[model samples]
Target: MPDEQGHPELEEIELGKVLAALADPARRRVIKQLLEDEAGAERHCTSFGLQLSKATRSHHFRVLREAGLIRQVDRGNSRMAQLRYGEIELRFPGLLELIRREKEEQASSET
Candidate 1:
């Protein structure tokens, strides 16, 4: 990856933080959105537009980074977030896919 100007790579993150971060619905939505793209897809944390406080957003991202779910770097004025696809896949096989499928099923049913 091109480092997004200032973000740490996946190898620099911790694992436990990622899990704790994803344990929440809001944070899980952030991860799910990022997973929609290929590797190195830089997105703003707020792109999820979750109804959360700014502090909460930062806390969620921090957890994801520490858990190894994402790699974020400062991009000039805004922070860019990217999912650690390969790293996460290696660590947990088919986990993302399964969760995403479940989420889709839930959404469909809700409609």
Candidate 2:
């Protein structure tokens, strides 16, 4: 698979990198948003509404893309992101579901 702007190839996606990417609360939020989107829908970076500077936001996106958790494509003047759910599931079955469930449980406990 062609790496987009130096993003990791599917075969090169390491568990450590994925776990590290998800370790950040901000990145997890991004993943949660992508998971909530309808299948095959792409989310624009600005649509995330993350309270972060442009450089920081770009860094998070880069981490996600590099971890192979998301695919980004340049559309006109904007960059769109889509979760690579299928690819990740193939490589790490049930991983996303587990993470989502854990996050939900944590949220409920804090409420």
Candidate 3:
């Protein structure tokens, strides 16, 4: 069950890994941006606007991809990222919704 890009598939994406990936503030921000995008729309890596250095950004993307939360593809010279919403939903049902709701609550409380 390799991804199109040849990344090895997890026999089962562990809940712990998913939780750990989401635990990072930067990765959560990336997930939030992906959730805000229209379904099926891919965002180029540059469009993320993360303030981190290029290497750090790449590391974040790698974590998310390996965690099965995102699918990335190279478009020309740029990488495009999109949430693996449907696949994740199939695997973990309300997990993403719970994360989104928590993020929304946090944002509202800060203002």
Candidate 4:
């Protein structure tokens, strides 16, 4: 079960859901960016610079959050996002490193 913030606990993270969430190229890009950013940095939704509809991007963020890949909170008028790196790493070793290594070419698709 997820917490009040809608984030799943480390022990509650399911691999199938995580993989499904990561399957989308756009979502993967989100993860990749989060991975590449400074540790513990919480980025705003607009900071990703995704040339996508606000609704579409919000969907992506929701997917990542529900899948336990990231955490999000309302910051002022916008939402702030951060990779659940340590939690994910504790549950699945080296998973994020693989995302980081994924070729940047695939992230070009804005959808």
Candidate 5:
């Protein structure tokens, strides 16, 4: 949705929603995978090795979308999901970096 300024209007996505979306390890893995891909390339949700039911997978994507962390677009039979990296970085600088660092720390601790 665009405001009068012709720029994409970022709706005030709830912090709770964002946190809820990030709370799941699967969702965090999804975000980490998306971040690994270079900008401008759209990723299909099924490309990830997430062992979730179809409905659960949809729910995860929906939460991420509603939280404004990702932008999903329909491309015929497949839907493409992309990280809103630039917009999110501008809105909350260092936030994603912190999350990634935490993920790395957790992985290292488990090893």
Candidate 6:
């Protein structure tokens, strides 16, 4: 079932879509930023600091949103994105933990 915002319900979230969305480094970076953010704090898309062009960034966000990894809503003139943390955690336990660990490893490797 779809929520009012059109995002997938927790039980309806699919592993394939989620994994496909995270397969893109840019989308994973976006997810990592949201994971690091304070709980329930929606972030403006521009705040992600991605190097992609506006259109490309939009595409990445859209892919994530459609995959049920994140929820996007309009806040005034800007689009806000937030990880579906609790839902994702309950639906696929340890998945976010794995993503967080992966990001940490990548960050350390880049240093």
Candidate that scores best on lDDT: 4
Model 1 agreement with the true structure over 3-101: per-residue lDDT tens digits: 444334556544565556666777777877887877679998888877789998888887776666778877899988988788778777787785566
Model 2 per-residue lDDT tens digits across residues 1-111: 546485677789999999999887778878887888887789999788788999999999999998999989899999999999988999999998866766554533442
lDDT of 1 at 93: 73
Lowest lDDT sum, 10 consecutive residues, model 4, at 102-111
TM of each candidate vs. truth = 0.75, 0.87, 0.83, 0.92, 0.80, 0.87
| Runs of candidate 6 exceeding 4 Å displacement | 1-5, 104-111
lDDT of 4 at 26: 83
Task: Give the total clashing residue pairs for model 6.
Answer: 0
Question: lDDT of all the models against the reference?
Answer: 0.71, 0.84, 0.79, 0.89, 0.75, 0.85
If both were scored by TM-score, which would come out higher, candidate 1 or candidate 3? 3
Please give the range of 10 consecutive residues that has the lowest summed lDDT in model 2. Answer: 102-111
Report the CA-based lDDT of candidate 5 relative to the real structure: 0.75
The residue pairs found clashing in candidate 2 are: none
lDDT of 2 at 67: 90
Q: Please list the Cα RMSD from the true structure of every candidate, rounded to 1 decimal place.
A: 4.9, 2.9, 3.3, 1.8, 4.6, 2.9
TM-score of 5: 0.80
For candidate 4, the clash count comes to: 0
Model 5, 19-83: lDDT tens digits are 78787777877888888889857999898778899899988888788787888887999988888
lDDT of 6 by residue, 1-111 (tens): 776767887788899999999887778888888988898889999998788799999889888988899999898898899899999998999998878878454743452
lDDT of 4 by residue, 1-111 (tens): 889978888888999999999888888888998888899889988787787999999889999999999999878887899999999999999999988998888656535
